[model samples]
Target: MALKSEQARVLRRRVLGGLIRNLLLFSGAFALACLAIETFMVPSIANWVADSTSSWRTLNSSEQFQQILTDQGLLDDANLFDLWVNEAVEGGYTNDAGTITEIQGEVNEMEDALAEYASMMADSPENAEAAAAHAKERAEKLGADVAVASGTNAAAIGDASTFIDDATALDAETDNARAVPLLPYQTILTAEAIPTDDASAAQAIAALRVSASLQELGLSLPEAQTFMPPETTVDAATRILVSAAVLGYDQPTLNDLLQSAFRQSQEQAYSAWLDLTSAEEARALGVSDENPVWQIQYGEDGVYRMRDVATYTFVKSFKLPLALLVFVAGWLAIILRALNRSLRYFDELSGAVGRLLADKDAPIELPADLSIARNELAVIRSQSLADERAAHAAEQRKNELVAYLAHDIRTPLTSVLGYLDLLRETTDLPRETLRKYANIAYSKAERLESLINEFFEITRYNLSAIPIERETVGVRLFCQQVAEAFFPEAAARNIRITVDAAGAGQFFIDPDKLARALGNVLRNAVAYADANSVIAIAARQDARTTTITVANRGREISDAHLETIFEKFYREDRARSSKKGGAGLGLAIAREIVVAHHGDIEAASERGVTVFTLRIPTQGEEIEGAAAAPRIPGATEGVQRPVEPVPPRTVRPASTRATSAPPSATARRGPSARPIPQRPVGERTQAPRQGTSPLNPRNARHGQVPARKTVRDNDATPRRRGLSR
Candidate 1:
């Protein structure tokens, strides 16, 4: 239980440690990822925002105008005004040749009128004096009118010529301006041909006003009309003259008018270009009027240009999210690897446990990396092996017990069968001989009965604790009485028996159980004791214990055998020869009985003497009523006849009836000279009388012994014997 608890604690600690380690690792990785994003990615995006804002702030109005011109492709090296004029002519916005033709025709008409007036004056001279006065007046009026009209026409023609020359010069200037790729806003002023030399700001303003008026009038003309009505034409000419007078010439006004016309055309063209180019398309080309990154800067040439100043870096677009993705993937992989390892560990452990449970004999194997200190598998495996060994040992002991019982029972049975067979076959035998065979057979039968009873005693001892009948028994007297039962057998072997009970007192024990225990010890002593050697039985007591020592001069038991002498089925004679040794249960049974009385038994042997000591705890509490003590079959009760030892080589004279022998004969021949009586062939023996010793001379002398008639002396046996002979 303690081992299992410790293993559980170790397992918990290992699991907790793994969890903490994984958590720390994940946290550390996440922190590093965040740090990288902050350190590298953040600055890049911030710089892009700052540059974009600065780029937008740098643009001015002139730069914006140039940017629009550049986008429309109008600022190219080609002559912009010439191209405009060509486009205007194709679309019929102006008719320059028709205007020149109209002016020439007007001059011709003035000349024709002056010639007609001269002819009228010459032809009218015939009307003489009366008509002279009228003609002269009309002539003067006509001439004056012709002169005025001619002068006005000639002035208009000169103005027209001047306007044409100025336009040609203005066109040349526009062509020059268009020659440079980056023309300035001031270039447009040059294209207008406006003379700034010696011009006052006020005079320039007046010139601008007159030029704006002329441009408006030209724009209002219908393309299909080559000439205006006479009144309208006259008014237009008067205005031109008035603008020229105010500005001192028409050239400045013409320059202003041209500049205005150029601007209007440029704006219209720029609007068309804007409509075709989307903001997104403009950014793709690296020049955006909308995006702040596409900034415009003014040069010393007074020209405006666009350039890209700021560009987005890769870090701003990709690094942070990419780093985050990498971190997540790495963390997931680590987690999966840990999960796989844990799963494999559990699989191995589960498989080992399953196989072990299926077959207890199977070997337990675990993963190599499993920690021996923390794992319980090793401990469990060792315990299983120990249990298996213990089970095997128990099985071996059981087999040995069965074999020993079989051999012991057979020994007594053989003798009984031998004697009984002899009686059945012999014909005309003497009555004494028949009685002798019968007596021998009966003694052998009793021995067999005793051997069988030992088996039962062994079974009872193993099943549970034997109920002990506690009583006050005289220790000295009990030992003496038990010793007396073995005297005849000891005497038959020429072995001496002695009892010593000095300092012994009445002991609280189970009397019948103690007697049985002592009988077993005494029987063993007699069987193995050498002839003429002494067997001693002594009882001693202390304040707490009563000790009985039974010692015999016999074959010395080895030190190894002595320790196991009281174990069931252990014997000094391993061969288990029935004539020389018992079934090895006697001492074991004795030990059981002693233990049931709260006592212990031990054995020792040295110097050719073997001794068994039985110690009972006399001071312990005694049980009041115990179950009836087990009766050992064939155990002597009243007047027990001592078992006689077999001679080395001797046949009995068959007439000895030991039970019927007189007390004087028994006393003279020694106690074993007579046999105990046997029952008749069909009759059962009566219950043995209690409290009467079979060896008592009084009972034998008074004829209190149960008797049986000799079978060989009967008439029926003789008749049967005669027929057999």
Candidate 2:
């Protein structure tokens, strides 16, 4: 019951955690979207509105009008004033400046007209004659008539309210500005005269009077000028009032006059500004000069309209909010993209971890698509991939080690079993038989021990559990000594061991390990070799490395076995361990020792010959000696050369037996690896005595031969040798 409760609690916790994670992920996504809209999208719309020319102009006008009201000391009740300003600025005073500009342009047009007249008259072809005639005429009767018309117009201006007050003040204060002279009665009456016999003269006189009055108006006055009209009509009074308001007079009916002007001007202004017709027509027309007058008349209505347009102020007001929105939204997109990448990374990581758990030794390869992932996630992915690779390499190494161990352990056991069987059945055999079986068993066991030591040595080397002891030894002496050690064993079986010295000095190496490796090779050569056959050990050195070769006579190794021959229990003959008594681990141990010394070992085999080569770094001086003498000088040559040894691992070869069978036939109980010539059973009936073959009489026997010719059949090998019964 307690365990069940615990399991349920764990399951609940997992479910809650998953729910929380999912909730957070969705919440983050929604929050990011909201931020994008609030921070960037809304502001972008506001900015677009603010940048519109009509909107911008509306905003500017409202701002200016508000300032005008403030400067006019009209902002007493702030809220009320704001409301009033909004109404007045938007609806009424919106285009006041535009109207002022138009009026100013009218004055400019008048000036331009006057200038054009002067330029045209001055540049005329008959200017001198025309000017004289016109002046004469003006100085006569026409000049008087022009003066009378000027007098009348001056009288009207004197009564006008815009000029009357100031003109009256100036006349009262300045002696030079005493009443502006009223035109004579004759000038006024001349304007009404009908054209008769002197029609041209009358028209010229009227033109002169208008020109003269305009000249007087252009003159600089002291402070004011005064005049009195002959009479004032209602139309004239209204005109006076309207004109006075345009010049900024405060009086009754002023607002009415301004309203009328505003109505007319705004109609024209809207058409031009909005391009109500085609753009070309709009360009040709403009706002009326009287727009401000009309706006002032409309009062609150116009101001409110303008103020409404200006409220875009809110859109442009806060700089930071808009920028903040954009910044937040853009960064949110980047973050979300990064999150997606992280999720992908988690997926890849999960896969890699699963592969690791399953102990897959194959490399875990990542897709190149990872380049699109976030940088940090990419790095994490890369590290995971690297870790997978490392794990795979370790796994492969472990498999190789296991295979090596199994091979090493089984080889010696097979040899031991084979020899034990031989010993049990050979109780009444010859002394040589007892000696041969005993020596072969001993050698096999020794090989097995060496293999065990090699495995330990390799483990220690990799683990750094043991330190190598380096000592100097004479190279020549070391080689000779190791060779002599194996000489007795070789002589026991009538085999010959030889050494060739290529140097004359001392060198450095782990003497013990080197000797063991060399001994294993020599012992192997002796066991597999023929009686009276020679095994040679030779050494040489170049600038970089010292080479030691062990050459031996035998059947050639197949190409398939050359690559793995140094591996533990990797025998050329599949049944070499079982039939001939070997652990098949000698070369493996030798290879390990050489590698520990930072050297290399290789094997090359050809027809009936095999060479095991070892190369190590050369020491300061090479060994000094004559060519080594053969331990057994009278030994006969075999089909192939011998393997050599170097430094402290040199050894002589033990004697071994070789025999041949007739071609095309098979037998057991002989050297499993011997390159024996075999013959068919049918053909052998006509052959000479079996015990009298020139190759070796012992090999020709039917019963058990001497130890020197002992052979054994091997598994996987057919009836290739006929030396055994």
Q: Give the top-scoring candidate (TM-score).
A: 1
lDDT of 1 by residue, 80-142 (tens): 333323432343323332332333333233333323432432355222232223322443433
C-alpha local distance difference test of each model: 0.47, 0.41
At residue 599, what lDDT does model 2 achieve? 60
Cα lDDT for residue 193, candidate 2: 39
The backbone clash count of each candidate, in order, is: 9, 55
Each prediction's RMSD to truth: 23.9, 24.0
Model 2 Cα lDDT, one tens digit per residue, 510-604:
67666666766667677677667777777765665566666667765554455345544344554323334333445655655555455655555
Model 2: residues with Cα > 4 Å off, grouped in runs: 1-321, 324-328, 335-466, 576-579, 619-725
* Model 2: lDDT to the true structure: 0.41
Provide the lowest-lDDT 10-residue window in model 1.
Answer: 716-725
Off by over 4 Å in 1: 1-429, 454-518, 536-548, 592-600, 615-725
